[model samples]
Each structure stands twice: as structure tokens, then as C-alpha cells.
Target chain A: MEVTINNIRKEFERFPALNDVSLKIASGELIALLGPSGSGKTTLLRLIAGLDFPTGGQIFFGDEDASHHSVQERNVGFVFQHYALFRHMTVAENIGFGLKVRPSSSRPPKSEIRRRVSDLLDMVQLGGLEKRYPNQLSGGQRQRVALARAMAIEPRILLLDEPFGALDAKVRKELRRWLREFHDRTGHTTVFVTHDQEEALELADRVVVMSQGKIEQVGSADDVYDRPGSPFVFSFIGESSHLPVEVKEKTVFFQGQPIGISEAAAGGGELFFRPEDISLVEAQDALFGKVTACRRLAGTRIAEIDIANDGHAPYHVEVEVPLHAPVALGSEVRFRPTRWKVFENA
Target chain B: MSDKARTSNPAFRDPADEGFATKVALLLLSLAFLIFFLFLPLLSVFVEAFREGWGAYYEALAEPDAAAAIRLTLLVAAIAVPLNLVFGLCASWAIAKFEFKGKAFLITLIDLPFSISPVISGLVYVLLFGSGSLLGPLLKSWGIEILFAVPGIVLATVFVTFPFVARELIPLMQDQGSGDEEAALSLGASGWQTFRFVTLPNIKWGLLYGVLLCNARAMGEFGAVSVVSGRIRGLTNTMPLHVEILYNEYNMVAAFAVASLLALLALVTLALKTLLELRFGAGNAGGRH
Candidate 1:
């Protein structure tokens, strides 16, 4: 089902948790709400799941306004960060809980519930472990059981709050791949909350980046990464270096000297570029800085460059160079940003 | 020298280990304290009851007043425990699962029975329901007896034992959290269903631990029950009150016999508690998530 969030505002004791957040999720789309802790990504996911109500908003599951509806009425499958598997119950019992708890008139027969539970276990790849309690299973297995339990209801939408967050790195990667495949196969309109940028970028069809209760940007992974709409997104999504600079007409200047770039908006602003977007230039007037530190990462060297600004603190930026590049401590390297954007100071 | 001591003794202590004398002294001190304060009193109760022989013990327990006391105690516990259990479940659920105004005040009220002396708890009931008070005369006019009746006894017992179950459950339920209930709700379960299937099972062990404690206190309560029961023989006399009355009347064998029964109940409670702790680990009951 397509999920629509219209002007959602949530406050905890007058402290805004999510302010005027709005988004539309297409049917069968896997969207990720990505942000750091306290950024309201989890709050948004909870709001969509009907675990919480928005102070001011309308949420539509398909065409129905479900803002004030209880989670039971919404019929959304929510997976908590801790899995929240019923620890006292067997895997089969946990999966069958939702069906069994239904009113008798609409409840499925016992055999049918059992069959569905078995099928769900099989789908989650834990078919024969039905009798095992949650504590008996590994973290990844428990999370899969939690997912199977959520899916047993065949909910309108699947909402996960850091579903793989409790697992170790290797398990996290494996579950990320497994979740993507599972989403493809089931194709339930899924919205997941995550702080790991890599997980969101790799698994989500569309990523909604939020910070401090407001959405910074929403786009596909490439769009957000390559064309960030705000300074926050540009710095948050990936490795980027920024410098205080002035823009005159279309030319960008640092410390009153032109750096040969003439495509900037006319204003004083901060210039942002990826660490790898700059190249070594022998030009005397090229924007340059002194290398204060160097560190080897993977097969490349990242040099920390400190640029002196006029009557202000020195600006620090990182430049990625080949492992064998002649970069050293205190060495002045002349270079310019091949690709950069200037966001006027606000 | 330390190396030589280690070689000679073959028991060199690590830095974390306390000195031998200190360890032995502390162990001996705790053992002595337990023996003096706990074991000795328990042994004396059983020893005193059997002093005049098992025949005397059986005769004393079979006495009409003692039998009536036992029955009254059982009835009081039966009435008070279940009520407190229900109240405790609701109270802890509200305190732990939801945020609301006056929560801290409600918690303090629940703990009122625990902090105040049991005598004061009983006196509070007296002041409220005693014949001199406002409602007592009104209740009497309605042809109802409360101050010196079974109702008053039950009220005092319930008041005294109110916090047992909730106190046991609040911290435990708080630790377990409301995540499971939320998950159940998200999957189409109603509030009642969520509580019945998810929250209840999550706190079952803690609930049982609380109920066990509440039952023990309800059965053994003396000061609270005494203040309201009027000590009527064969009528309002509970086990603890009967023991005191027998002791005061110079019925030594009968008093100790009844006291022994109370001690037995206490022992049984302790055994069950240990069994539960062994079965479900200590301090929050049921294994930590």
C-alpha cells in the first residue's frame, strides 16, 4: 500500500520531535528514514506504524486517514530495534500470536494458523526451529523470527526500527542483503529507520534524510549523494571538505585571491567538495594549504590540509591522494576543487 | 620474599584477593550472625513446640480455638491475596508502561504500607472505620458491622500487604519495557490481547514472586489484624493473634505450636522463593532479556 504522511508534527511536552514532516511512499517501495540518534527518524517510523500519534498530521494507508487509528486498526507490521520477540514463547507460538488474538468471529482456524506460521518460518528460513524459544536462538535468528512474526499478520506495510541494529557487523551485512531480497520477494511497502548511511543507501529505493526533526533531503541514493540539497546532507551523507570562501559574480575566492573557478553564485559562503574531487595543480595562485597530518586508509592516503583564512581561524579539510603521492607533514600542496558547490551563509 | 612465600605455601594470592585473616574473619562473622539471629530462633520455635511431645503438639493444634485461628488465617489470605494481586498487576502496569501525572505520588501511596509501621497502618483503618469515626456510625446505622468485623480485618490486611506485589513487579516490568506490548499492538492485537499474551507472560515470574510474598504477609499479619479483629475467640482470631492470645493466657504449648505453624509457613515460603530464584534467577525473577 502507498503510505502518505501529510504535515506530521510531533512534540514531547512542547519540545518538537518532528516538525512539519511530509512524505509520500509509493506502493511496494522500500524507503529508509535515515538520521543520527535523536534525529526523529525512529519517531517518524513509529508514527507511520501507529505506535505513536502525531500532534498535527494525517497519515493515509492507501486512501484511508489513519492518523488517530490504533496500531491494531492500522494493521502495520512493526519490528523493534531489540527484536521484541516474546521471550517466553516458542518461535511458532510467537508467529501465531497475532492470528490467535483476533476476535473469534474473524479468527483463522487452528490448523490454518499453524500452516501460516510454518510457512512464515520457512520464508524467514527457520522452518524447523519452531519450538525453540527466543533465548535459544542467535541474534540474527531471533531477528528473523521477529520479522516472521510481524509478517504473519500479512500487514498493510512493514515498518522496521533498526531491525538489524543489535547484530554484529558481519550479521548486519548478511541481514541487510537478506532483508533486501526478502523485501523484493514479499514486496510489501516497507519503511525502515536506520542511522547507518551505508545500510540506507544500499537497501533503500528512496532515502529520506532527517536531522533535528526536519527532513534535510529525500531522493534516491545517488541523487542525495551526488546532489545534496543542503549543507547538512552534503556533510552527512559522505566524506566532504568545506572552506570559507567569498563569491564575486560567478568567481569563487579564498582569502581575497581568485582560484580560477568562475561558476559560483555571488555571495560570501562556504564551498564544499568531496575529498577526491580535487587534483594537484602547479599554478602559483591555485587554492592551496599546508599538510599537517597524513593517514593511510585502504590503498590511499588522506592528507589533512589546514588553509589560513584572512583574520579568522584556519579551516581544516581532507584531501585524498594516491598512496605513493609526495605528501608529507608541513608540505604546502597547491590544488583546486575540480567540483564544488557554495552554500551562502545563512 | 613474596616469591618464596608463594613457593612455600603454593597459595599466593592475587592482588584482587583479600588477606586470608580478613576473609576468614568476615566469613565467620556472617556465619555467626546468621546462626544467632536466624537459625537459633527458627530452631527454638520448633523445639519449644515439641517440648511436651508430638502428642501434645497435635492436641494443641487440634484445639478448637487454634483450628478456628488457622481457618480464619487461611480465609483472610484467600480474600486478601487475590485482591492485592489484581491491584498490584494494574498498579505496576500503569506505573511502568505509561507516563502520567501523579505517578510518583501513586507509587509513594502504594509504598505507604511498607514505610509506615504495620501498627500505624492498622490504626489508620481504625480511625477511618472505628465506631467513634464518621463512617463507622453510618455503617452501623445501615445494619453493617465494619470496625470490629471481618470486613475491617480484611481491610487492614489488604492495606498492610498492598505494596508487596506491585513493589516486586514495578522495577521488573520497567526493565522489561513496553516494547513487546507495542509489537503485539502493531500486529493487530487489541490492548487486552496485548496485555494477556505479551505483557502478562513477560512479567509472570515477577508476578508470582510478588503474590507469594503478599500471601505470606497476609497470613502472618498480627498488628494490623489485631487492631480490627477485636480478638474475638473462635471468630475474629487469626493465627498470629491466636498465638499471642495463647501466650498471654499462659497456654505455652499451644502458643508455640501455633507459632511453629506460622514458622512452617514462613519456611515453605522461603523454600518456594529459593526454588523460584533457582528456576528463574535472582533479583527481577525470570531471566533478564
Candidate 2:
């Protein structure tokens, strides 16, 4: 079902968690709320789930006003970061808990509950292990059981608060892929909160970038990654290095030397670009600098360059080349910016 | 190099070294203290209970007053423990799950009995129920004898043990936040159902531990029951009171016999505490969320 959060605001004592934020989530859309720690992403998700009430705002599920509804009335499935599985319950019992708890008018038959539980377990790929307890299962398996339990009641919207956040790195990657597939198969409107940029970029149909209790930008993965609306989005989404540049007339000068601008220099601003965007070139559009350090990474060698400019602090630049690339410390080289964006310093 | 000599190298020694001989010596000293202070007294009680073999046990069991005292103690426990359980659950739920003005004050009120002497608790009830107090006339008008009656004893026991279960449950419930309850609520469970299925199951062990503690204390209570119970033979007299009456009347054997029974109850209490720890230890339950 479509969900709308209108001017939602929450205050914890003196600090504001959500500052009059509004967002519309389309029906059956999988949206990711992406931000760093303390960005209020999880708070927004809790408000939608009705686990928490906004200090001042309204929430709507479709045409119905759900602002005053209790968590039970909201009918949204929430999977917590730690899974929060009942340690005392078996997998089958946990999956069937929602169905069993339904009121008499809405309760399913015993056979139906059993059938649905089995179906959900199979959907999450834990079919044969229905009798197992949470502690008996692996971290990834427990997360899957949590997902199945959330889906058992056929909630209109599914909410995941860092579902794979507690797993190891390899398992996290695997679960992210499986979660995306599950979302696709069910076509359930889902909102998952995460501070992991890679997860947001890889899995979400729409990424909502939040900063300081406000939506910085909301777009598709490519839209937010390639064309960030603000410097916060640019710096938060991917690894980027900053280069100081002074805009003189229509030309941008890097360290007092005139450097070619992609277009007209808009004025004095900070240049933001990814390390992968900058290339090590022998000449052309070159900003001369000295290599301060070099290190070998997993598949690439990274070199740190200090671009010396007069009257200004040395610009720190990182360049990633092939592992086989020949480079040494204190080596002089001419570097160029392949792709860059300018932002006014805040 | 020989294996022992090679292993003795300082570089190969443990970085987190603890002297083995010192640890062994400390452990032995602790065991000696436990035997001398705890097990020795318990052994003495057991030996004294069976001093004249099964004859003394049967003689003690056959006494009408002894049987009446045992029944009275059990009845008091039955009334006190369940009431304390309900009160403790509510008090702990309020203190742990909700925050309000004067919450700390309410917690201190719950712990008042634990800090104050048990004799003081019994005296407070006696003052409220005796002939000199305001309610005494009203109770007398209704033909209620609370000062030296079963109800008086039960009330005093309840007051003395009120904090046991709540004390056990508050930290557990507080540590296990309202996350699971919220999850169950979101899953379409009503408030009562959520409490019955989710909250109760999580705290059941802690509740049981508290109830056992309350029961043991109520059964063996001496100081509080002695003050309020007037020690009427086969009437208001409980086991502890009976023990005192038998001893004062120069019935040393019967007094020792009843004291030994109360000592047995104390032993069972220690055993129950140990089992409770093993069954529902810190690592086994609570703190899930």
C-alpha cells in the first residue's frame, strides 16, 4: 500500500530527531533510507511502523489516516537489526505467531496457519528446519527466519532496520542479494534503514539520503550517486577527496596556477571527486604535485599526492592505479581531475 | 632442547600470567570457609533432627500442636506468596517499563522492608490492627480479630516479603526492553495476549525465583510472626512461635524438634536458590532484546 509521512517531527528532550520531514512511498516500492549514524533514518522508519508517535505530524496508509493507530493496527512487518527472534520459540512457532494471534473474526484455520508457515519458511529457504530454535541457526539463517516471520501475516508494508547489519561481511553481501530477490518475488512495499552506502546503492530501487534529521536527497541509485543534490550527499554516498580551488574570473586556479575548468568557473569552491575519477596522466590539464606515500591494496596500489599551491594548504589527493603500476614515494607527477563538482564550504 | 626446558622460556610464557600455586591456595581457602560457615551448620541441623533415629522423627510428627503449627505455616505461605507475586509483578512492571514523576521514590518504597527490620514491619501492622489503633474499633465492630489471627500473620509476612519478587524481576524486565512486546503488538496481538504470550514467558523464570524466595521466607519467618502472633497454643501460634512456647515451658526436646524442621526449610531454600541459578542463570534468560 502507498504510505505518506507528512511534516513528521520528533523531539527527544531538547534535540530534534525528525525535523518536519515529509516523504511519499509508492505502493510495492522497495526504498532504502541511507545515512550515516545519527542521521535519523531509523527514527523515520519507527514512526511509519507506529512503534513511535511523532511529536507533531500525520501519517497515512493509502487514504486512511494512521497517525493515531497503534502498532498492531498499523499491520506493518518490522525486522530488527538483531533479528529479535523469540529465543524460547521454534522457527515454525515463531512464523505462525502472527497468524495464531489474529482475532477470531480474522483468524485462519489451524491447517491454513501450518500451510502458510511452511510456505513462508520455504520462501526464506529454511523449509526443512522449521523445528530448529534461533540459537541453533547461523546468523544469516536467523535473519531469514526473522524475515519469514515478518512476512507471515502478509503485511502491507515491510520494514527492515538493518536486517543484515549484524552478520559478517561475506554473509551480509549474500543476504543483501537474497533480500532484494525476496522483495522482488513478494512485491511488498519495503523500507529498510541502513548507513551502509554500498548496500543502499546495490539493493534499493530508490535511495533516500538523510543528514541531520532531514532528507538531503531522494533518487534512484544512479541519480544520487552520479548527480548528488548537495555536498552532504556527495560526501556521504561514496569515497571522495576534496581539492581547494580559487575561481578568478572565468578560470579556476589550483594552487595559484591556472587550471582548465570543465565549464566556466562558478567562483571559489571546494572540488569534490572520487579517487577513481582522477587518472594519473603524463601531461594535459596537469596539476603538478609530489607523491607523499604509496601503498598496495587488495587489487590496486594507492598513492597519496600533496599538490602544493602557494598561500594555501597542500591539497591531499588519492590516486588508485593497477597493482602492477610502477610508482615510488617522493616521485614527481602531473595529476588531472577527470570528473569533479564544486560546493560552497559550509 | 627438552620439551620442559623449551616451554620454560620467558618469551614463551603466557602474557596473561596467573600464578597457579596462588590460585590453588586461594580456592582451597574459599572451600574451607564455605565448609566451616555454611555446610557445617546445615550438617549439625540434620544430625540433631535424627538424633534418636526414626523414633524421635515419628514422635515429633505425631504431636497435634506440631501438625497444627506446620499447617498454619503452610497456609500463611499459600496466602502470602501469591499475593506478593501479583504485587511484585505490578510494581516491577511499573518501575521497569514506565517512567513517571517520583519513580525513584516508589522504588525506594518497595525496598523499604528490605532495609528496615522485619520486626518493625510486623509492629507497624500490629499498631494498625491492635485495640489502640483507629482501625481496631472498626475491625472489632465487624468481628475481625486481625492482631493475633491468621490474617494478621499472613499480612505481616506479606509486608516483610513484598520486595523479594519485585526486586528479582525489575532488573530482568528493565534489561529486556519493550522491543519484543512491541513486535508482538505489531503482529496483531492484543495487550493482554502480548503480555500473556511474550512478556510472561520471558519473565516466568524470574517470577518463579521470586515466588520461591517469598515462600521460603514466609514459611520460616520468626521475628515478624513472633511479634504479631500472640502464641496461643493450637490457635494463633505458628511453627516459630510454637518453638518458643515449647522451649519456655521446659519442653526442650519438642522445641529442638520444631527448630530442626524450620532449619530443614532453610536448607531447602538454599537448594532452591542454587537450582534457580542453574536453571535460569544470567546467561540463560532475560536481556534478549
Candidate 3:
């Protein structure tokens, strides 16, 4: 089902959790609601799932008004961050819950429910563990069971609230790939909330960047990662280092001297570039910076550089350079950005 | 690790790490306290009950009034316990799952019965039902009796026992949170279905404990029941009131016989509770899963 969230506003007491947030989700599209904690990404997902109602505006499934529909009527499958598997029930029972809960008129027969549960168990790769309780299973197994349970109902839309939020790093990465494969095979119109930008970018077909309860940008992974629409999106979506710069009429200047011409089209703002964009060189016009700190990694070294501004302040930025680079402590270096964005505001 | 620590701490002893003498002294102290305060008093009740031998003890229980008292106590427990159980579940659901203004105030209100003297709890119903109060004349004119009747006794017992199940459930359900219920609802499960399948299973042990406590209090209640029972010989006089009546009339054996029965009921309740605690270890009262 295609979901349209129109001008939704949610208020708790006098504070707004979601303020005029709107987005459209295409059918069979895997989307990510990406934001920091308290940014209302989970709130928007909850509204879409019919777990909560908007204080203002409406939600539509295709052309039908879903504002007044109950969670049962909305026909959504939600996977919680903490798995939320029923502790008393075995894995097979957990997966069959949605089928069993249907009204008798529409509920699947017991044998059919059993077969479907087993089929789901195989899909999630936990086939023979049907009789095991949730507590007896590993966290990853429990989450897979939660997913299987949600899918049993064949819901109109599947909503996941940080599905891998509680897992360890290695397990989280494994589940991310598994979930993408699952989505591909199942073709469910899914929307998941996550604070981890990497997870959102890697798993979602479209990423909706949110900040302070407002949608900042909505685009494909590359679109949000590269051509961020606003400073918030640019700051939030990817790893970018920033330096305070001055932009005057025909040129962009760093430390009161012209540095580049292409960046002058935008007004004075903070210039942001990824660590890979900075290169050390012997140029007189380059921004002079001192290597303040260095960290060794597998094949590269990360250097924290402190670049002094025209004023007394300095901006500290991290750059990943080749391990052979001359980046010893207190070493002075001249550097220039190969690619950067001027956000037009400091 | 033990050898290293012991050598280093040859003179650096933790006072709490005791020798046999200290352990024995603490054990004897606790035993003495239990003997004087708990076991001796319980033993004395059994001894006094059999003072006139089993014939007279059995006769006391066989009396028409005594039989009526036992039946009334059982009936009140049956009525009061289930009513309180339902209230407890509802209260726990509301207080634990949903956030609202004045939730603390509502919780405090639920705890009111725990803090109020039992005499005051019964007095509240009396004030509402007594002849000089509002609605009293209207109820009297309608041929309805509340105070000095079964309804009054049931009401008092319900009031005193109402908090048991909720007290057990709220902390637990709150800790477990509405995560499972939300998961159910999102899976297209109805509200009733979600509660029955997810929320209820998670809180089953806590609910069982609450019901046990409510039933025990309902059956053993004396202060609040006495205030409303009005000492009606075969109707309102519950087991505790019967013991008081027999003892005051110098029927020592009869009084002790009834008291002994209540004591046995208390012992059985304690034993069952302890057994359950040993089995379940108060685990997941907060709905861990």
C-alpha cells in the first residue's frame, strides 16, 4: 500500500513532537525515517502504523482516510526495537499469533497457520527451533521471530521501529543485509525508523532525513548522502568536516584570503567537506593548519587538524590520510579542499 | 583468589565475614525472636483450642452460627477477590501503559486503602449508608438494606482488598512497558486479543500473587468487617467476629477452635506464597520479555 502522511502534527501537552510533517511512501518501497533521538521519526512511523493518531491533519492509505481507523483496521505489521516477542509462547506460536488473532470468519485454519509459521521460520533461517521460547533464543533469533510474526498477517504495510537498534555491531550488520534480502523477496511496503545514518543509508531505498520534528529532505541514498538539500541534511546524513569560511562577492576566502571561486556563488557560511576531500600540499594560498592529534587504523591514519580563523577562534576537523602522510604531532601543514559545500549560514 | 586474599587480609578482617561463633550467635538471636513473637503465640492458639479435647473443639465448629460464619467468610472472599482482581488489572493497565496528568495522584488514590485504618475504611461505607446520611432515607424507602447486611460486609472487604492485585501489577507492567501490546496492535490484533494474548501472559504471575493476597485479606479481615457486620449471629458475624463472641462469653475452647482455624488458613496461605516464591523467584514482575 502507498502511504501519504499529510501535514501531521502531534503534541504532547504543549510541546510538539511532530510539527507539520508530511511524506509520501510509494508501494513496495523500503524507506527509512532517519533522525536523531527525539526527532519524531518514531512518532511518524507510529502514526503510519495506526499505533497513534495525529493531533492535526490526516493519514491516507492510497485514497482512503486512515485518520480514524484503528490499528486493527489499518492492517499494519510493526516490529518493535526490543523484539517484543511474547515470552510465554514458543517461536512457532509467536509467528502464528497474527493469524490466530484474526476473527474466526477470516482467520486461517489451524493447519494452514501451522504450515505458514513453519514456512516463515524457514525464511528467517530458524526452521527447526519452533518449540523454543523467546528467552531461550539469541537476540538475533528473537528479532527474526518478531519479523516473522509481523509478516504472518500479510499486512498492508510493515513498520519497523529500529529493528536492529538493540543488537551488537556485528549482529546488527548481519541483520541489516538479511533484512534487505528479506524485503526484496517479500516486497512489503516498509518504513523503518533509525537514528544510525549508516544503517538508514545502507538498508533503505529512500531516506527521509528529519530534524527537530520536521522533514529536512527525502531522496535516494546517494541524493541525501551527496546533494543534501539543507545544512541540517548535510550535517546529519554523512560524515563531513566543517570549517568556518567567509564568502564575499566574487570569491570564497579562508582566513581573510581568497581560496576558491566556485564557492563564492553562495553567501557567507560554514564550508563542509568529507575527510577524503582534504589533501596536504605546499601551496601559499592553502589554509594553514597544525596536526593536533593522530590515530592509527588498519591502513590509514586519522588526523585532527586545528585550522585558525581570521578571528582568534579555530575549527578542529578530522581527516583520514594515507599512513605515509606527514602528519606527526604539532606538524604544520598547508591543505586545500577538493570538494566542499557552502551552507550559506554559519 | 581466596588464598591470596586471606593472606593479605590476615589482620584486615571484614567484620561481617563471621566465624562459627558469630554465625551461631546470629542464628540463636533470630530463633529466640521467632520463638517469642511468632511460634509461641501460634502454638498457644492450638494448645488452647484442644484444652477441652477434640469433642468440644469439633462441637464448636458444628454450631449453626459457626457454620454460618465460615460460609459468610468464604462467600465474601469469593465475591470480593474477583471484584478486586478486575479492578487491579484495569488500574494497572491505565497507570502502567498510558501517560496522563495526575497519574501519581491516581496511584496514591489506589493506595488509599493501604494507608487508611480498616475502621476508617468501614466507616466510609457507614457514612454513605447510615440512616441520617443522604440517600439513606431513599434506600430505606425502597426496602434496600446496605449497612448491617451482607452488602456492607462485602463492600468493606472489597475496599480493603482492592489494592492487592494492582500493587503487584503496576510496577511490573510499567517496567515491561507497552512494547508487546504495541507490537500486537500493529500486527492487526484487536485490543481485547492483544491483552489476552500478550499483556496478560506477561503479567500472569504478578496477577496470581495479587489474587492470592486479595483472597487472603478478604477471608481474614476483622477490623473493617466488624465495623459493618453488626454482629448478626448467623448472617453478618464472620469467623473473626465469631471467635470474639465465643471468647467474650467464656467459651475458651470454642473461641480458640475458631481462632485455630483462621491460624491454619493463614499458615496455608503463607506456605503457598512461599512455595510460589521459591518456584518463580518473583521473576519478570516487570515483564522482562
Candidate 4:
């Protein structure tokens, strides 16, 4: 079912957790709400799941207003950051919980419930572990069981909050791929909240980036990654550094020097560029910098440069240098950003 | 102290531990205190109850007042334990699962009964229900006797035993958290269904443990029940009150016999509580995930 969140605002005691947030989720499309902590991404996911209600807003499920529906009436599946499986229940029981708890008129029969539980076990790749309790399973297995349990109800939309947030690094990476495959197979209109940019970008069909109780940008992974609509998205989604720059008449000037790359007059905005977007040159009269440190980072040769900003505070920028480049400490080098963005008053 | 020797014994102490002499003295002192206070008192209860012979012991217990007291105690516990059990579940659910202001104050209020003296607990009810207080004449005109009646006795028992169930459940539920409850809600389970299937099972042993304590306290309550019971013979007097009356009457065998019953109840409560602790405290139950 398509979900439309219109003008949603949530306030807690006097502080707003979400402000005028609106989103439209197409049917059967998996999307990720990605942001830092306290960014209202989780709150939005909870609102969509009906676990929480917005203070002022209208939520529609396929043109039907559902803002006041309780979780039981919403028919949405939610996976918590922690697995939150019933510790005393076996895997099969946990998966069949939703089916068994349905109203008697709609509930499946015993045999059907058992068969579906077995099928779900098989789907999560833990076929014979039905008798094992949640505590008996490994972290990844517990998470898969959690997903299986959520999917048992055949909800119209599945909402996961920090789905892989509690796993080890290696296990998190492995399950990221597994979750993508699972999402593709199940094809539920899924919205999962995550602070992990890689997980959001790699898995979701669309990534909605949020910050400070507002939606920073919403687009495809490549769109948000390459052409970030805001400065927060640029620095948050990818490795980028910023320098104070002045924009005048659609031209960018740093340290009173116009070194070429210019776009909109984002007006006294900050310039941001990825580490790999700058190249070192030896030109004496170009935008000059002093190499502070040249070192290997994650097996890549990177140089830290301090750009001389005329009369202002000297700011630093990190750029990937060639492994054999002679950009040693105190070396005077000229550099220019290959691609950059300047967001005004950010 | 080689590492092998230090680690081999399960009674391993740190290198900066108390000296050997202090450990020995402390161990011996505790053992002596247990022998005198715990072991001896328990041994004497059985010995005295059976001292005059089993026939006499049965005769003492078969006395009308003793028998009536026994029935009264059982009835009071039967009413109090289940009522407090339900209250405890609600309190634990509200206190543990939700956040609001004055939460600490509410919890402290729940703990109020545990701290106030039993005499004060009974007195508060008496002041309210007795002739001097607000509801006294209204209750008397309606012929609903509470003070110096069985109702008064039950109320006192309930007050004294009130905190047991909630006390046991609060920490356990707090530790278990609202994660599973929220999960159940998301799984389309109604609030009552979630409690019945999810929250209840997770806290079953803890609840049982709480009820055990509440039942024991309600049955064996002396101070509060004595205050409110009015010492009415064959009517409001519980088992402990009967023991006191028998002892005062110089009916030593009868008093000890009734006391033996309460002692046995305590023992049974301890046994059940130990069983629950062994099951839950041994970390065998699959705890929160």
C-alpha cells in the first residue's frame, strides 16, 4: 500500500521531534530513513508503523486516513534494533505469534499456522532451529528470526528501526546483503531507519536523509551521494571537508582568489568537496597550500594540507595524493577542487 | 600464592583480600549466629510441637479456637495474595514500560507500606474506619463492620503484604524492559493478549516468587492483624493471634502447636521461594534477549 505522510509534526513536552515532515512511499518500494542520532528518522519510522502518533498531521494509507489507528489496527510489521523476540518462546512460536494472535474469525488454523511457521523458518535459512529459543541463536540468526516473525503477519508495510545496529562489524556487513535479498524477495513496502550510510545507500531503492528534525534530502542513492541538495547531506553521506568561502554573483571566492569552479550565489556559503576531488600542482601563483602531513589512511596515500586564507584563519583540507607524490610536510603546493558545492549560510 | 592455587579453588579471593585470620573469624561468627538464631529456633519448633506426643499435638491443634484461627488465616491469604498479585502486575507494567514525571514518587508511594510500621498501617485504617474518623458512621449505619472485624483483619493483612508482588516484579520487569511488549504490540497483539502471552511468561517465576512472599506475610502477620483483629475469640483471630492467646493462657502445648503450623508455613514458603530462585536465579531460564 502507498503511504502518504502529510504535514506531520510531533512534539515531546515542548520540544519538537519532527516538524512539518511529509513523505510519500510508493507501494512495494523499499526505502531507508538515514540520519544521525536525534534526527527524527526513527521517530518518523515509528509514526509510519503506528507505534507513535504525530501531534499534528495526517497519515494516509492508500487514500484512507490512518493517523489515529493503533498498532493493532494498522497491520504494519516493525523490527526493533534489538531483536526483541520473546525470550521464552521458541523460534517457531515467535514467528507464528502474529498469526496465532489474530481474531478467531480471521486466524489461520493450527496446521496452517505450523506450516507457515516452518516455511518462514526455511525462508530465513534456519529450517531445523524451530525449537531453539531466541537466546540460543546467534546475533545474526536472532535478527533473521525477528524479520521472519515480522513477516509472518504478511503486513502491507514493514518498518525496521536500526535493523542491523546491534551486530558485530563483520556480521553487520553480511546481514546487510542478506537483508537486501530478503527485501527483494518479500517485496513489502519497507521503510528501515539506519544511521549507517553504507547500509542505506546499498540497500534502499531510495534514501531519505534527515537532520535536526527535518528532511535534508530525499532521492536515489546516487543522486543523494553525488548531487546532495544540501551541505548536511554532502558531508553526512560521503567523506567531505568544508572551507569558508564567499559567493558573489554566481562566482565562488576563497581567500579573495577566484580559482575557477563557481555555481549559484549560495551567498557567503561554505565550500565542500570530497577528498579525492582535489589535485596537487606546483604552480607558484595558483591557490596555494602547505602540506602538514602525508600518511597512509586505510591503505590509501592521503595528504593533509593547510590552505592559506589570506588574512583569515587558515583552514585545513585532506586530499588523497599519489603514493609517490613528493607532497611532504611543509611543501608549498597549488591545488584546486575538481568538483565541489557551496551551500549558503550553512 | 601461585596462580594455580589461587584459581584452582572456587573460593578464590583476591590477593588484596582480608587476612586468613579475619576470614576464619568471620566464617565462625556467621556459623555460630546461624546455629543460635536460625537452626536452633527451627529445631525447637518441631521439638516442642511434638514434645508431649503426636496425640497431644493433634489435640492442641484440634481446639476450636486454633482450628478457627487456621481457617481465618487461610481465607485472608486466599483473598489478599491474588488481589495484590493483580495490583502488582498493573503497577509493574505502568512503572516499567512507560515514562512520565513523578514516576519515582509513585514507586516510592508503592514502597510506603513496606517502610511504615505494621502497627501504623493498621492504625491508619482504624482511624479512617473507626468511630472517630470520616467513614465510620456511614459504614456503621450501613451495617458494614470493618474495624475490629474480619474485614479489618483482611485489610491490615493486605496492606502489610501489598508491596511484595510489586517489589518483586518492578526490578525484574525493569530489567526485562518494554522491548518485548512493544514487539508484541507491533505483531498485532492486543494489550491484554500481549500481557497474557509475552509479559506474563517472562515474569512468571518472579510473579510466583512475589505471591509466595505475599502469602507468607499475609498468613503469618502478627503485629498488624493483632492490632485490627480485636482479639475476638473464634472469629477474627488468625493463627498468630491464636498462638499468642494460647501462650498467655499457659496452654504451652497448644501455643507451640499453633506456632508450629505458622513455622511450617514459613518453611514451605521458603522451600517454594528457593525452588523459584533455583529455576530463575541459576540463569537457566532464557532471559531477556
Candidate with maximal lDDT: 1
- Cα lDDT of model 2 by residue, A1-346, tens digit: 9999999999888699999899999999999999988999999999999988999999999999999999888899999888878777788988899999998888999999999999998899988998887878999998999889899888989999987789999999999999999899899999999999999999999999999999999999999999988989988887677777777776667767666665354677887877677667776556767889888767777878887766677878887755786577888877667788887656
Give each candidate's interface RMSD in Å.
2.9, 3.8, 3.3, 2.7
> What is the C-alpha lDDT profile of model 2 across B1-289, one tens digit per residue?
6557747875565557667797899899999999999898877766766777778776875699888998999899999999999999999999888879899999999999889888988899889988989998899999988988898999999998899999999999999888788778878889899899888988888888899888888888888888899887788888888888887997666777888888878878889888877768753543332
Give the CA lDDT, 0 to 100, for residue B258 in model 4: 90
lDDT at A243 for candidate 4?
84
* Candidate 4, residue B277: lDDT: 89
- C-alpha TM-scores of all predictions: 0.96, 0.90, 0.95, 0.95
Where does candidate 2 stray beyond 4 Å? A244-248, A254-257, A262-268, A279-288, A297-300, A308-313, A321-327, B1-40, B46-56, B59-64, B99-106, B127-145, B281-289
List the lowest-lDDT window of 10 residues for candidate 3 chain A. Answer: A259-268
- Top candidate when judged by DockQ against the true structure: 4
Count of backbone collisions within predicted model 4: 0
What is the two-chain DockQ of model 3?
Answer: 0.60
Native-referenced DockQ of model 4: 0.62
TM-score of each candidate's B chain against the true B chain: 0.92, 0.89, 0.93, 0.92
Positional deviation of residue A102's Cα in model 3 after best superposition, in angstroms: 1.2
Model 1, span A45-109: residue lDDT tens: 99998888999989998899999898899898889999998877888999999899999999999
Fnat of model 4, as a fraction? 0.81
lDDT by residue (tens digit), candidate 3, B1-289: 8778977888866667888698899999999999999999999999999998999999999999999999999999999999999999999999998898899999999999999999999988889999889976789899988899998999999999999999999998998898888887877788899988888878877788788888888988999989988999998999999999999999999899999999999898898888766544534432233
* List of clashing residue pairs for candidate 1: none
Question: Of 1 and 3, which scores higher on lDDT?
Answer: 1
**TM-score ranking of the models:** 1, 4, 3, 2
Worst 10 residues of 1 chain B by lDDT: B280-289
